[model samples]
Target: MSTPADPGQAEPQFILYLDGEAYEEELRLLATWVHALLLPVYAREVTSAEPWCPRWWEHQEAIARLHGLWLAWQELTDPAAGPSGPALWHRDHLGAVMHELRSPSGPFAGCKQGSHRPKAVPVVEAF
Candidate 1:
């Protein structure tokens, strides 16, 4: 068995884990809300001077923080070796969605092409 890590280490391991999970959850929620709730609304309004937008910048910073937290967690979890945490996070979150969308055509796909197929619906658009 591997020796346990030092709790007094600079990294709060649990915080890293939580941040990474939150990042993925938030991303999935955003994707779900956009795809399931939003509607395509066309508006004919164009001006050279859009209002001074600080919110967009704020959101970008938030996303960057999430990314940083995830990477930091990954580094802590496995120093020289790669951890499956991030990969599993992606597979459990985004990969599942994509898998539902893409059809498994390979014969050895383990099952005879299940009869269930999810609806291919485009639910969100932004101008």
Candidate 2:
């Protein structure tokens, strides 16, 4: 993914599930991407019925899972993956990830449509 760095600056590389100590640069870049690009785009699909957490950044599981999904997206959609890459991404990654993330009992349980924060409710906090 592209970074805020100038074109002359080499972009940082990332791998899924690496040690934070060894991959701080890559981790930061991935976080930036997830927050900046992924969330905004994904938010549009969130309906009141499908709920999503606006404070998803604070949710460790969401971050980790999304990172893994993002990594899979990159690999599965690459040119080298051939003509079926997009189809594979849709079938194998997007469907599963979106279901887990947007399920009624999932990360966004009390959230509403659009860019809303989770509704205040009396429930145990999530990881």
Candidate 3:
């Protein structure tokens, strides 16, 4: 997922996966968009009933899923995707991803409506 040095000069592209090996520039772009765009617009729907992790960056699975969804959103919303793109995104991406990420026992289980901060838990590495 290496970004070209002059990516701005070319067609806009994004990393669809959240691997650590993903380009630093791509990660930065995604992070900015997630913080600046996605959260502010979408997070209002998150509640005690359908919780979402405020510290979603700490969760690798959530990050990967969200990045993929974001990439699909970008692609499907473009004019080049044609009229059916939105339908495909809603059917193939949005519903499932939202369900998983907001499931009661999912990554956001600990998060509540008003208190949305997540405490990071140390990962135990198997060597």
- Compare the candidates by lDDT and give the number of the best one: 3
Candidate 2 lDDT: 0.66
Error of 3 at 45 (Å): 3.5
Per-residue CA lDDT of model 3 for 1-127, tens digit only, reads 3223334555445454324655556667668878887777665587767887767766666777877887787778767778998899889998888788888777788877655556457699999
Candidate 3 least-lDDT 10 residues: 1-10
| Candidate 3: Cα lDDT at 4 | 30
lDDT of 2 by residue, 2-74 (tens): 3323456554344544566655665676678777777676544667567777666555556667777777766
Model 2, total clashes: 0
In angstroms, give how far residue 70 of model 1 lies from its true place: 1.8
Candidates' C-alpha lDDT = 0.35, 0.66, 0.71
Clashes of each: 0, 0, 0
> Against the correct fold, how does model 2 do in TM-score?
0.61
Worst 10 residues of 1 by lDDT: 48-57
- TM-score, prediction 1: 0.22
TM-score list, all predictions: 0.22, 0.61, 0.64
Candidate with best TM-score: 3
Better of 1 and 2 by lDDT: 2
Error of 3 at 14 (Å): 8.9
